[model samples]
Target: MCAASAFVGYSYYENQLLADTTTHLLEHYNSNYVIQNLQGTVVNTWVSWNLIQGQTLHVSIVNDANLPEDKITAIKDAILSNGTITVDDSLLHEGPQGTSSTRYKGWEGALANLQSLPTKFYIPQSFAISEGSNGAGDVVITLTNDENPDGLSGYTKSISDGNQILKSKITIYQSSQLSAMQLGAITRHEFGHALGLAHSTDPSDLMHATIRTDYPYISGCDIDAIKGLYSGDERSQVMCQ
Candidate 1:
């Protein structure tokens, strides 16, 4: 009788432990973004440049409209704030090939000294202004005066194969109306997209579909989301803490 009682007690303890472990795992899995496959199995889905390329993302800046020097500088500064920027005028511009307009030339001369920038935040990634052919894994930023019917200030389109992002194109529209500060905010937001971040539900967050924040810089929540993304958390939309 005692042997049977001991056996029952041990079985109860083992079952309870397993139950607790399963609950913990479920909680963790549900917290991240997941999708159901055709086979009826849940799977994680996330896209990131780091998954294919290394920590450094090469960038090519093409000023098609010849936005003022300060505006161009603002764009570079915004990128530098997140990571280091190496200016190389020699990099062949990417995207929209065969334009003979000399006005579409890439920015010449070095970017303004980083120390002059008012603020600098650090992330794991870096950017290089490089010359390369189209679809060569470069983030091409183009400044243009084209007006969008949707009235968007900027737009980012990323090309990906599977979970890896091959390249990205960021176009800034209506450059004449935006001030330097406004241009910087828009650049930061689009750059986030280039890094594989989706829109955030928070209006105050930089990743919002429409930027309305007075202090439109990258926040801690944005950093946390990036860390989660690179770590394989597939969240449909970022939620602020």
Candidate 2:
């Protein structure tokens, strides 16, 4: 890790996959994202070798009342469409962060910035709760506090149990560095990797390498790629996945 001003680092473990599937952590912007995929096949231990493992993906979503529930779910569904996504209830409402929460400041900053953008980052709460719970690890969030030091904004990553449960020990950020558009889009994209999908060079898809303009939209091709892996008999493989 660099100094507090520029914190970033990258380490890799050998072959490690849950049920032999890949997990990508969005390559993370400024290297603050966590790629949770590496775990011991034995269930409790994390894959001490590779960068991806652990089938259990625990992520806490973040946002303010300004963001609609439906929009968040849409993003959640997009991620669930590939694999499991979970959000800890502890971080969902105001219960976890409490009043003097550090997440409050960044949440306000992030929300204010998102509101300024003309994008409709809204999703149905029902969809968010249901789709996320539809077997994929998904979580609807509000208090933002995962300790990802990438300036937050719009970063996504595939987290392993160790990084989440051991290293950061945080499933979500306490500071509000992620934008509404980012919160939804990055989770969907990163989760895609969790399901074994890799980064695509296509900027028109959510699985694109970077968050290019309009890249948040899950393109038909990207969707097809995901479906192909689980349902269509095609193997899923992409860079970093």
Candidate 3:
């Protein structure tokens, strides 16, 4: 039942799943990101952008929480650093009610959890989690409620807060049994929220309106957006406000 919310910590455990890991000096790149192979099988990823200052991210996962807590911080770091995160684990199974306890069915409870987290960053206003048929599937979480159903607790970070407020909670399917596809998509999408991102219209992007496992990591636009948010802020400036 325990869900581990991983950020940078996951990179230390499981094998790096990101197909693109090319990161180098962005000043010399012609594209938003440059992908290079370190070896025959390994790739190095990098993005060219800066984020607003004073963004402190927090990661937390409890039982049935959809993420493993031990990897929460690593997860946050990866999201902030644009998918440079990983974790190490034997892949242990948590009980129905392990250390992870963050759970909810609908909007009220889930939103409350996000608002209550201890951090300066905050989530943006978003549509509540509801049930409906989206053209992509029975439920697609499009920008509008009737358009699509995200199927998981939706999230968006606040630029005003440097996208650090992750007090938002997550919601799992009530069926008590979910497929790996659903879990991966949901985790990726919600974590996107934690990183201050929104759904991209492009299907190739993980933030696509439809909840699918097309890309399990952040994209170039996502990296530029995050860095833009974090780049301008000076450490001392945040303290005054």
Candidate 4:
């Protein structure tokens, strides 16, 4: 009887410790992730595919812009790559150091402490290109020479139900003027939006508002932000710093 009572007490203590740790980690995440709106209201605007829809994001390329085979392939490849998210441990450690800013030492430290916490988080998704859009996919990419009213090279619009994304459309403008490499970069940036990523504060990152980076590939910060979004955390934007 005494042994059983001791065991029960230990269990309660362990559970409480876990809860406290999780709370701290969440606080840390919010400090770095959450944003405030113009009305001074805390808004967590990040949205992404729910578990069901994200299992497989079927994509259909309309190719209406009549891009060449190479450009078409580049666009397809870019979509596929961004769909696969892999967090870089190096990046987690590269951010601002010291615990003065937060209780945790750094992103790596926070993630390490969070590893034991049980939470519903996003898993990496797979992307498949459906042939001719035989009603197989919810994402549509249209390549067109039609210039955007905003004069942007690419644009993406996503429809979401609540915080869950339902479908997305990507429009690439002035495709004729873009080289295959340029098309690939633009496709990557737009596809990031289709996958529910907001623009990064870092201009050097691929998800920036403008595609000016010489290497317009997905960055570690982008992956980390997506992971946070799919985890159901509402963050308006994510920054590498």
Give the top-scoring candidate (lDDT).
4
The runs of at least 3 residues in candidate 2 whose Cα sits more than 4 Å from the true structure, single-residue gaps closed, are 1-143, 146-175, 232-234, 238-241
Candidates ranked, most accurate by lDDT first: 4, 1, 2, 3
TM-score of each: 0.61, 0.37, 0.35, 0.64
lDDT (CA) per prediction: 0.59, 0.37, 0.32, 0.61
**Between prediction 1 and prediction 2, which has the larger TM-score?**
1
Per-residue lDDT tens digits of candidate 2, residues 1-241? Answer: 2564343221212234321221232223321233454563222222111213223334444443334666555445444443322333244242354332221111112222222223221211122233222223343333344444554423333334632322111123422334454555665555444444556654434566565433354444454454444343334443212
TM-score of 1: 0.61
> What local lDDT score does residue 144 receive in model 3, on the 0 to 100 scale?
21
Task: Write one digit per residue (lDDT tens) for candidate 3, span 1-241.
Answer: 1235564467644444331221111011110111122222222221111213322323333333333433333322322332232211111122233333122222222333344333333332123223223222111222222211433233332222222331333333321222333334455555544433445555434556554322344444444343333343222110100
User: Where is model 1 poorest over a 10-residue stretch in terms of lDDT?
Assistant: 101-110
What would you estimate as the lDDT of candidate 2?
Answer: 0.37
**Which stretch of 10 consecutive residues in model 4 shows the poorest summed lDDT?**
26-35
- Name the runs in model 4 displaced over 4 angstroms: 1-44, 81-121, 131-136
Put down candidate 4 lDDT per residue, 84-149, tens digits, no spaces.
333343343444444111221112222333344443554335667854634336678877889676
